[model samples]
Target: MMRGFDSYASIVFFLIGIAFVWESRKISESSYGSNVGPDIFPMGLGAILVLLSIRLFYEAMKAPKGDSDGKTTPDYKRFLMIAGAAALYAYYLEDIGYVIGTFLFLLFCFQTIQRGKLVTSLVVSASFSYGVYYLFVQILEGTLPGFPSWLQ
Candidate 1:
């Protein structure tokens, strides 16, 4: 049987995509002397999201009836931990800087999801956090809170 969660998620994603697309139009249509506008990325992402959500809904609906494997209990505690960590991460991203905030968040999430493998988790989290920072800040020349003002 198809899970109701899948249907709900599809609807949510579809709505979010619609909102993004609609809101993107409010941004200025042209960038100084450039054909590409600031809205292009968001609009493209929204379009992709809309398409993926529709595909997900279609797949959910088309699944064979009575095909569900036995229900498995969700780990609500882990879910809550991750969710809370994510919220905190967002709030502290600017204060602590993207690299530190993301590293801490990812580390917490990794350990929360699966205990053990401390070394692996640390390496992976560090790699991801720094990689994203380097890509966006250095390569793309985008601004992100680097380090706390006190540290700089």
Candidate 2:
């Protein structure tokens, strides 16, 4: 069951990655007065996604045969919660701003995946969200919502 699910998920992710890469190509390269291109992030993400999906497929294929006792069940509730968080993050990204939205989303996901370790989750989430924000806004000169107006 796990093997079948992994294979199917990997294929889906692979297609999504391909689509991302393809669509990114249509974006005009380089923002005005900036050396970094708008498409760089998406393209890089797409590439990473493709590579990881391939790896997932390999892992699924290499998994040893196991007895499929009907006792094991997939955690649909957890999956749905994470999916909803992801959707909200995407929908309100501009409104909530990148740093805040990403931090909250990542934190939620990390905690959902493994409960406890609040400090570690907070540190990692803060680091990733702020790090990416800085990379794009400061270094790359790409536009991303930094903070909501109320936070100013």
Write one digit per residue (lDDT tens) for candidate 2, span 75-132: 9999999999999999999999999999999999999999999999999999999999
Supply candidate 1's per-residue lDDT for 14: 100
lDDT of each: 0.86, 0.91
How well does candidate 2 match the true structure in TM-score terms?
Answer: 0.84
Compared with the true structure, what per-residue lDDT tens digits does model 1 show for residues 1-152?
34666667898999999999999989987766445568877998999999999998897788666545346678899999999999999999999999999999999999999999999999999999999889766775556689888888
Residue ranges of candidate 1 with Cα displaced over 4 Å: 1-3, 28-48, 51-55, 58-64, 67-70
The lDDT, on a scale of 0 to 1, for candidate 1 is 0.86
Judging by TM-score against the true structure, name the best candidate. Answer: 2
Name the runs in model 2 displaced over 4 angstroms.
Answer: 1-3, 67-71
What value of lDDT does candidate 2 attain over all alpha carbons?
A: 0.91
List CA RMSD, all candidates.
Answer: 3.9, 2.7
Clashes of each: 1, 0
